[model samples]
Target: MTSIKIEHVVHEKCRIGESPVWEEKEETLLFVDITGQKVCRWNPKTNQVVSVSVDAPIGSVALRKSGGYVVALGTRFASLNWEDHSTSTIATVDEDKPNNRFNDGKVDPQGRFFAGTMSQEIRPAVVERNQGSLFTLFANHSVVKNFDQVDISNGLDWSLDHKTFFYIDSLSYAVDAFDYDVNTAKISNRRHLYKLEKDEGIPDGMCTDAEGKLWVACYSGGRVIRIDPETGKRIQTVKFPVDNTTSCCFGGKDYSEMYVTTATNGMDEAKLAQQPQAGGIFKITGLGVNGIPPYSFAG
Candidate 1:
């Protein structure tokens, strides 16, 4: 186990802060406030924050190789120009299932955009009958259905070798590993690599370090745990002040710093008062590790 220190860096009070990605080229962190329908950028060096509003709920965002960002907005995928806040639709998913919306996603090593959907009506007592699905969008604007009947499709990333694909279906309470073909961007041989106990909380988002350890954000657990994918054991744990810790990514010049996002969507006034930093971005340092550079969307 390693000791870590967590600090609150942003006080935006986002409704649903998620998708923390570090843009090394810009030397800043990018994230989305889903319910607020805004994309934000934070520069740690200057302590400056910039936000851009979108038309609909923005689930996740990925950097584009050319410039700007590719975002999953509500039921459609669009390209966003950060300068003018202008958006152009690229493709739409699950047009028939109005109850479903895009959730967590990332760009693959091959430069393909892979995002998943979830029911908008998620609750503790009510189980949503509307199943979610995952889709892959190519540079040519062609979309492919990868998997279906998914419940709250969440975190996703490839192993250090880019041969094993890891994904999380939050409702399933497990981290699944799949055989990945980088050349074709195809995944198969799916199997459960680790399952979490209910008390550990649900896994929301994840990323891999250069050493092949998987870092998972434990939603209700108020912590981020690093797991040994091959052994299915937790190697390190970094605690946060907020309970709804949503997602995390490594940033900074050396990638030693960790950025985390949390949510305040379902909290009432009392709960919000107890957790004032619920929706703020957190920074963790002294982990003594670095992460691989994030892949960008080629399209």
Candidate 2:
């Protein structure tokens, strides 16, 4: 196993930075801070950062094929205007409940947006139930599929060949895979590809490289684990100082760089003191295969 070292690329206060993507068209990295209610864009080539606030809490974001980006807000999905910072809701998940919210999501090769949900309970503690559901929004706006009864919905990605789908149920400590029917937009044949010990921090965000391998961020394990989904073997590990490394994405001209987003929202003072790099963005260069270009919102 190769020792992984984390390099802090940007140090900023992000309440909970989660989803990250490299927009090849724009040559920038875009991410969301759910609790911060904001979206940010960073240009590694120019070394600049630009951000904007959203009306509601945002969970995930992705570039659209049309020219803009799609966002997963508290209970709805919307399109974002990066230049003007304007967002318009396109789909609603739980409008009647108002207690549940969207969590993490990504787009598939077919330009369909796949998003998950989380508990909206106000008990000041994480609850396993009361979580939202998974939804798929087709470009035509006439087709919407709902997969319900979820708890802490997190990472998502598809195999390089687009024949399989991988996902994370953070609290379950398991990474699962399903046989994907692209034309029918259905997932079945569920099986476990990786399982973690309770103490290894929950698995949150994930992405697949061009090599068809899985790269997952360890919520509190303070590192990213590169695993071969088929064999369920750990191929590599990237360590971080903070225990709350949230999500990661591959972006760059050649998609060689892996950009990571971290968090500090649920940490106590002692933990925060132990890791000042908790909310910053980190990058690992010169390694791993590139990732498939993110699918854009079909406008």
Q: Number of backbone collisions per candidate, in order? A: 0, 3
The sequence of per-residue lDDT tens digits that candidate 2 reaches over residues 92-208 is 877666677788999998888899888763532276584567788788754364566677889999987789999887777888998998886688888889997666688999998
**TM-scores, each model vs. reference:** 0.96, 0.94
lDDT score, candidate 2: 0.83
> Which residue pairs does candidate 2 place in steric collision?
64-297, 65-296, 65-297
Candidate 1 per-residue lDDT over residues 145-259, each given as its tens digit: 8888888888999998889999998888899999999998888998998888777798889999989999999888888989999898888888888898899898987888889
Best by TM-score: 1
TM-score of 1: 0.96
Alpha carbon deviation, residue 201, candidate 2 (Å): 0.6
